[model samples]
Target: MSANKTAMGDIASSTETYPFEKDERYRSQQGLNGFAVKEPFLPNGLGLQVRKRKMVRKRKNVDESPFSVLCAWVVEHQIGLSLNLLLLLSLTHFFFSRARPYTSLFLGMSYYNPKSKKYTQGWEDMYFVATWIIIITGLRVAVMDYILKPIARYGGVNKPKAQVRFAEQGWLFCYYSLFSPLGMYIIYQTKYWFNLREIWTDFPTHTMNGLLKWYYLVQFAFWLQQIFVVNIEEKRKDYWQMFSHHIFTSALMFSSYGYYQTKVGVVILAIMDVVDLLLPLAKMLKYMNFRTACDITFGVFIAVWFVARHVIYMMVCWSMFSEIPHVMKQGCYNSTTGQMISEDGGTAVWWNVMQPFDRPGGTICYNNNIRIAFTALLMALQVLTLIWFGMILRVAYGVLSGKGAEDSRSDDEGEDEEYEEIEYYDDKIKSFDGTNEIVTRTIALPIEEDVNAEEMNLGLRRKSTSPTTASAPRRSTRRTGSARATALSIPGHSDKKDILGRIGCDKPS
Candidate 1:
């Protein structure tokens, strides 16, 4: 036993001086003899020669079932598929006489009078609106993914989350930029342009021009698609609030259209769309890191939001409350013939307070309860806007305090926390052809100081006692000791000293 101990001591001492012996020691410790790769010495005197063992991983075969393949293909080509469907429908509607009536129901405005340049609302308009919803969704996806994503990447929005946001804002900027002006132009043509009382002047018989009908339907389609967008996309902090807003907005538009109150709806849409243009512009600037532009755009957005939402929109809401009783024709009326009939079955022109039950048998007539509910929905929208405005103000305050602008409602990117830091070691050396070479071996281990020593030790011990380690040839302990000592001496890792000592690695003084 004494002789064996002396021989081991001599072997450990010789390993410290000789590079070849050290390499042999490392190979034995790692249990890699036949698998060990020999390389020429590096020109750098650092004596590094990394030999990474190639790991052959068999890739998992994905589900190639017909359903899975079809699903995958659909996901990849959804925009193309939607466009193709739209084209097919358009072609069928144009060329085929048999399909014309059915397709016309969904493809064009119902009750359109070219001579009068007006359109009357019908159940067919619902199908038309549904078709427009699909069209908007497809166009939105195509524009964002194909056009804006590349632009965002080019503009230094590298992170995936930032790129997504940039593309979303870019798409919104394009949409609102186009529609905001279109809405204003439509409103400008109307007799009720900025005139709140005129919204209720004609009531259900209010004539809708082709432009206004298309615009209102398309706007409604956009908001309905937004409901899908908020749900399908990555959720933000204000997701529920946004969800509620979209729902309410869609409901308000749909109810107004159904009740033939689109004059007020159009005015509300015109007022709301103007500020939407600036918000997305500001967000796009922010994502691109144009701090000055973002701040300026955001400031403009705030001013417009206050005017459009708080002042003008509230005026429309108030008009619904105060003007409907006086301006609108009251009592149960024939919506088609525009004739009011009293309960005694006589044609009566009664200009009285419209109660919920006052509508005896009218096809379309607004009542007090319906007006209150409609007004309440508009109020609810305002409440939601106020909540968002508060968030915007908070962001504005942050900007004032020199923090620069940031969306308070945006989701925080914590993806970095999932990554582990890579640690490099230059101490691992190999000897080849009479020159010493350093070998770089990457081992993934948590570098956080809070990592438990016992867990780390367990991991190391498992690696040290692996099947490969067990089959390794005997080697000098001195080289292994030196490597461990180097690891222990790593800066700011004093806590690891005792763990290294306990694991047969000497602690450096």
Candidate 2:
């Protein structure tokens, strides 16, 4: 009895502090320490699954229902880009020449350029290429390996393939690329028989310039239309969102650009080349993890663009600035046979693309050193902006939509992250219960202290000096103590109880 009073005094005097575990019933309410969360002890007739069945919803607040315009822009961008890569590659052969010592080569034969005094060699066999191989082969693994594949499988990348009824049309991409630079060009001196300077750069050329300027304007206008709708509809997937998709397509285009430039890493970004070849088929087979596939595709796209650009810029200095002439020995008068060879200039795409511009002006600027085209410069600038703007817009949308982080749903859905189903158990799943008297919605959940849940559970099992048990037993123990004293004195108190006539249950007043 003395010990009990001492313990009680200690807990009471320490009023300055209340140990976090002050009650057991409250703990039980949350479910006994932690073996599992207590579902309400449900009676047979009631369960939650019957109550909260899944709901399907259509998107609301989407402002731009005119999807036709967006689709049209997408088609135009793709077609224009494909033509730029295919036409130029088919007509350009400067990269295959081994006479150019810096170029990568696996196999080829030599050809004498009488116009240029040196013997030029060709290297066309592609063997053991490194970076391009990784980009290509890694496509499958990126989509299927680790966590990414699971996430992708959760997405709708798995769908049925429709049969193709017709054969593909040929663009002569491979042939023109191999033969054009080899001096096998069938038309005028080079593939660009329509050089504006040859026809005078004043009227029609100026008109071409206006058309190109309009393409840029229309491209950005589509982006603006998409972003505006995203702002109102609170959707994460919008036209602004679609620009990020360009990372893949642009990478492919630039690889062809690198090939046109004849850089050492011509094949570096080629992973998607094969991806381009096989992704449609893979999607048809339902053999793709969509999230991982897009991610892999995006990563390789970005890497190849940056690395290929890096290699091209670094290699361009030597390949173009070196002073070896095609055939100076033939002399200027005799050299009037084929494309004009100037001894002072370097060889490569830097010359091929820009030579026309310089000849018209009768002056070339070497001040920039590498002689990079203003057009290529503009492209590099835009690519950087594209990446930067995409990231910025994501953060903007998240902040604007009040979703602190961006989550992807269907392309039609806004930027909200799809909520995953909360799992309880796998084998013989124990259903969730709201009325079982333990768990409830968070609005009704009682607040608790931050003690480690594991440590708290350990204390419950040991029961020795458990703070929860100590504080909770006061009333029950007091009732037990008083009951014992009353039983001991009951015989002596009988007269007192009879006088009051209220002590014994069998006695009636």
Candidate 3:
């Protein structure tokens, strides 16, 4: 790369006349070509003296203190504050749930205890959820900070961002490894099988055991925490898309749990979470600057993502469509047994299908409409996952083609920017004549590009070209070159009249 420097320098220095002369003239008139001074080019009568307006922001009051500023900051970041509050609530719930086996209170609302052998509902269910959130938080923190970070560092990942990402991926991997199997086991035990219509015929009525309940709560809290964490972390190009995803997935899981669709919910959770484990690990590798390994893992991630999200989710949709009507025809409520009976054996029926508990005299009611709504929502979730999959494809292409070495899809930083400061020392020396001589010595000083300089360049680009393509110059690939060398090597540098003096290049004769 360095060998091409001389060729690039020749190209930059060879020409005096450049393209965009009209652009430069127009820019001068518009004050886009370095700061153009206002002058009377026409007759004095036609000259206009326009005054520059100074923007004055209101000053802070002297009475304001640091504590007040801190409070204001907290208030401004409402989402972050809300998440913290929720975490505190979860922790409180955990302590109470442990201390008292089955009872807890929040905001003066006593916990609701489900009838023995009945599904969890009301306050007891919500209480259990809070407790499980705390447990998941503890597990996630333990795995990410302590176990995964150290192991990744030992395996040659030294960058802090990479370590953090690896830890997160490790947690995901560990979580699904434990939970997905259990979810499968639950489906097997419930006899839901692969038939979609079976869900309607034998909809879950049994009270959730501690393990399945914990799983649902953990799934809910994990994504909820992600919503908060992602906002506070370095923002990516698709930040909002990911934010939407976390919200959707979290809401869907919680709603499914509330609706007593835990049997199907477990399957969805298992399928959706498996692919996520690999993506972060690939990104972590990319952050660690391991190109080959990252590409390999990314390839694998793509394959797994397709199978899990598209293939498996398609099967889920198919089953729902086929099974719903079959169960609807035969479904009937049994008041004595508190179960829904159908032609199919042990079908997990939804609560909506049975007669309302309050209306004891009403005939067995059927509300198959809720089933349609559920199917649509589930389909919507799969569609959202597909949208994210498109982004993943773009990233994978970038990695494989060497077009984007850093994951442009991610915004994590592993290394800090280097800062070099040169200090000048001044000392006085007394001569034989008793006259004091002052001497000052300063070593090599690092010059950094002005932050606003890029903005100004962007303005110039916008003025000279089609606005759609206008941007600051592309970042240089060579990271260790001198500023002067960089200036000489940039494409179209010779055509940029305003840049010559700024970069210490000689004016063409």
Best by lDDT: 1
lDDT of 2 by residue, 1-509 (tens): 01222221132221122223232333443322322333222334323211111112222333355685675454335434434543443344365454334332311212334554333111221221221222222322233343334433444333211011000001112212332232212113422243212221111111112222222222223233323323433232334533444443333333322222221112212211332333222222222223334334434533553443444433332333332122121111111122333424343444433432233213221222233442344345346545544553453343334333331222213223232221111111122344444333211111223343233332221122433222211111110000100101122332211110001111111
TM-score of 2: 0.25
TM-score of each: 0.65, 0.25, 0.56
Q: In candidate 1, what are the lDDT values of residues 73-164, reduced to their tens digit?
A: 76567688789889999999989999998998888878777888777776567788889877887888899998999998898778786677
Error of 2 at 416 (Å): 9.6
Candidate 3 per-residue lDDT, tens place, 1-509, comes to 01221111121112222232222222343212322223211121322112121111122233368886775575355445545665676576677667444444332222223555333433344554554554555556666777989988787777676576667667766776676676777677765666555665544443466566656766777777677556655455457767877887876776566555677778888787677666555545543445456546656777988998899888887776776566555344443343665433233334443323233323232345556667777887777777767765654443334332223233332222223221111121111111232222221111223233223322222121321221222232221111111112133433222111111111111
Question: Candidate 2 regions off by >4 Å?
Answer: 1-61, 65-365, 369-509
Q: What is the lDDT of candidate 2?
A: 0.27
Q: lDDT at 432 for candidate 3?
A: 16
Evaluated with TM-score, which candidate comes out highest? 1
lDDT of 1 at 7: 17
Model 3 TM-score on a 0 to 1 scale: 0.56
